[model samples]
Target: MLKLAVCVSGGGTNLQAIMDAIDNGTITNARIEVVISNNKNAYALERAKKHGIQSVCISPKDYESREAFNQNFLAKLDSYQVDLVVLAGFLVVIPEAMIKSYRNRIINIHPSLIPSFCGTGYYGLKVHEGVLNRGVKVTGATVHFVDEGTDTGPIILQKAVEVKQDDTPEVLQRRVMEQAEWIIMPKAIDLIANGRVTVSDGHVRIHE
Candidate 1:
């Protein structure tokens, strides 16, 4: 089985989606080996525990430096022999070393259609607020490979959600997240698992 490790920093709705997909055989040949969170109280840890998957907490404050934190984090992942790393609402910027170690094996589900409302300071409700503020007619979710840059990795999948005239950031976010759970993240992981994903020339190609 292809082993996957999921990292999270929030409620982990995406994590729950992946778990549901796995339980329903949507991801046929993979196993979720572990779920790690930087915050001990993150609901994702509880979700993982409920599924009987190993859950770990590695707080950033526990380490002296970013390098040390990343080194220890990488070591923990290595122990699991993780074939893929999924960032489900994980808030921290992955260290360069960890990014180098995982390369194309790491994937992240950003809350917005990236390259637009995504960067160092954009996340969660902030991204949704940006979208609403911009008066965009449409906005949605992005699933992409993780690079050293912030949410700048090659996109694997995206789904558009129309911005209603009266939609609040919370409502818009909810709509996008619904699409993410049912479509974006699962499709991206499927592409990887089926050997249809290839990264070349700074792009991700999903073979038909």
Candidate 2:
């Protein structure tokens, strides 16, 4: 079975979707080994508790330095023996060492379709706001392997959501989550767990 360590920040709607998908058998041959968050009070931890899944809180503030926090986080993940690290809504920038260790084993769900409102300073509702400001009729979510650079990994799956004529960032964000993010994130995990996904030279291929 593919063991997963889901990392999140803030509320965990995406994390909930992943749990739901696993429970519903949409994502087979895998189970969540842990839910981790930088924010202690993140609702994702509570959700994990309710599901009897182990949860941990590792904040940079609690450690002496960023390097210390990164080391601890990597150690924790190694202790769990996780096969995949899922970044559901994780707000923290992944450490370089962790990225090197995990490599393409780490995956992330971005709010935007990427290459649009991604990279530095674009996250959460800010991505939706950028899409709205750009007047784009179509916006979506992307699941990709986590590389050293932000959102510059091999894309796995993307599902587009339509932008409404009179939609605020909050409304658009919600719509995108429902129509895109929630769907593709779990789907990507399912694909990876089944050994259908492969990365070659910074590109992804899905086996038939």
Candidate 3:
């Protein structure tokens, strides 16, 4: 069985999707061992508690530097014996130490189709706003390995959602979550947990 850890910084809609997938047996051989959050008030923690999953809140303010925070965070993951780390609405840039230690073991879900309205400043509704501002006919979500660069990791899966006229950022965000993010993130997790995904030559190939 694969021990899973989820990190979050906001409302855990993506976290919920993962849990739902696991509950429905869509993701086999994996169990969410812990849910970690940088914000104590984050609703993701509450979701974890509701499901009886172990929850940890590690405030960055408690640590002096990013390296210190990463060390403590890595310790928690190690203590849990986590095999996979999922960033579900986690906002902070993952530190180099954690990135290096986890490597392809960490995955994240980005709101917009990556290489588009993504990277440093693109998150939450800002991504949807950017897509609308650019007048893109379609936008979606990307699940990728967590690399040092922001959302620049090798893509695992992408599902596109139509951008409708008169759509507000909030509306588009919801649509993308329902149509894309919620679908592919869990599927990507399933593929990884089941040993069906391989990363080679800076790309991912899923076995049939």
Q: Which one is best on TM-score? A: 2
Order candidates by lDDT, high to low.
2, 3, 1
Better of 2 and 3 by TM-score: 2
In model 3, state the lDDT of residue 174. Answer: 96
Q: What's model 3's lDDT at 133? A: 94
The Cα local distance difference test for each model comes to 0.88, 0.94, 0.92
The pairs that clash in candidate 3 are: none
- Model 2: how far is 26 from its true place, Å? 0.5
**Candidate 3 at 19: error in angstroms?**
0.7
The TM-score, computed over Cα atoms with residue i paired to residue i, of candidate 3 is 0.97
Cα deviation at 182, candidate 1, in Å, is 4.0
TM-score of each: 0.96, 0.99, 0.97
Clashing pairs in 2: none
Name the runs in model 1 displaced over 4 angstroms.
none
Identify the runs in model 3 with alpha carbons over 4 angstroms from their true place.
none
Q: Using lDDT as the measure, which candidate wins?
A: 2
